[model samples]
Target: MPVIVLEASDFTSPLFLVRTLEILSSCITFSLVASLEDSELNNNPSNLHFDTFRIFCMFTWCFFFTLSLLMHILSVIQFHSLIPISWKNLTMTVAVLGALMCCAASVLFPWLIMDKTVSPRPVVAAVASCLTFLAYASESFVLCTQTHEQRGYMGSMPGLLKMFQMSGGCQMIPLVVEVIRELPSGVYMWQMWVTSVSYSVCVLMSLVTLVVIICDFAGRCLLPFDRFLAGFSLMGVLLYMVATVICFTKILQLRELGQQISHESTGLVIMETVVASITLLAYTVDLAFSIKLLCDRGHA
Candidate 1:
């Protein structure tokens, strides 16, 4: 029979505590939302839109909770050593992504269901979701405290900028989704295509690079990593610049032709424009840092 040894440190570490909190809060949030009666929902017919919000919150909480539990079990059993990827990197990636999803869900859920419903389930669920978000954010910060050398590429400033690039891109997604759901198809089709391409490419590239580094494959890359990052960041900058111009122009045109656009669609477009601008700034800085790294490596 195989021995089943437990790693006591897994239970004692601050990360362990954070993960425990994450698991508990996620469960609480999921339960509160799931427990809401159909009668409660029927109280406000307008709350039919809340089905999407409820589903989103439920999925986010369940996904994170399951991951947190699996991570904890793996740690306790010391199975992470057998995993292919860098365990630290995997943990950090989960923490960062979970924090972002939970934050977005927490913000959106309450706004969608709180005032619309008579029951207090959504309000409590929102609080639990916020706590879960905080736990994940704390986990990310804790993981980041390691020395740059120890944490590899993800600990570098440009690497962190890559995270911001991904985050800014992701923030635009909800706005785009809202716009698509609310507005008729083929309306602002060009603007939508351009914006989608810009953020999608940026997010995909950044995510791929992050995954490569996390998998410890950066050193084995065919192209020099620094040069590759420089090129990628430059591409992100150009894409975002074009997106910003097109989106802002559309916004301006809509404002001038005010009656042609609904307030809701206009608000979504404005949010997308702002997020695109911020993401562009992040990409610009990332490009600069990538260039600096390339030059520094060349000199060395």
Candidate 2:
């Protein structure tokens, strides 16, 4: 039942062009990495070790490529009107979050996989990823700079905070997962378990909050949305604070325990500790914004 619109303006728009670049760059990155993976398999079948960087890069590219392609398809077919979510909000949210994830992939690919002895293929893929990230960022910048009336709620200040919170929470999920995986089975301390749970809950809440806002459920929800945001932001702050404290305390305890933990495991724990502190800071700032928004709504 969907009809094609095929507007010339749509294809020629800056956003459209940027999206094209995103798709192209993602494909190039994926192809390069795939080729490398193939070469590795053919040349060295014995290397069964996990390559987290390779898988992460491939997943990031594949996800964004598919998402961007879907958006383009929906636009050409004029399917926005039929969707329950705000099309503009959905697109802008994709742009913002895609940019963040792509940037992280770009950084991690080189840091984890590349060195002076490495081949040029991964380097090229990394460059392509960086270009893809820039393309997404360009689209985000254009959408964000548009008039408030033209842009959706996702482009606003509080909305941007939501994006940051969501992205930050997402970034932490991998770190927590890595830490938990690295920790020896049946040896994870209470601190580690509590920290992991807290991180998971915070990330889940952030994702739900973003989804509610982007779907324009803010006004229609049972509880007042601003109050919900304020309350959740406060909860996130507390959760991250506790996670950070426990993470650091565990690191110290590990030092005292000594010789029982692998250096790589300790490093993973330290990385999570640092990231938890940073996420805590982000939540604290978001809490301030949420409080201000709540107060303004109360006055209105």
Query: Which pairs clash (backbone N, Cα, C closer than 3 Å) in model 2?
Result: none
Clashes of 2: 0
lDDT against the true structure, each candidate: 0.79, 0.79
Off by over 4 Å in 1: 1-10, 35-59
Alpha-carbon TM-score of each model against the true structure: 0.87, 0.87
Q: How many clashing residue pairs appear in each of the predictions shown?
A: 0, 0
User: Each model's RMSD to truth, in Å?
Assistant: 2.7, 3.1
lDDT of 1: 0.79
lDDT of 2 by residue, 164-231 (tens): 76776666666666666666676656776788688788878978887886687888878888789888
Model 2 worst lDDT window (10 residues) = 41-50
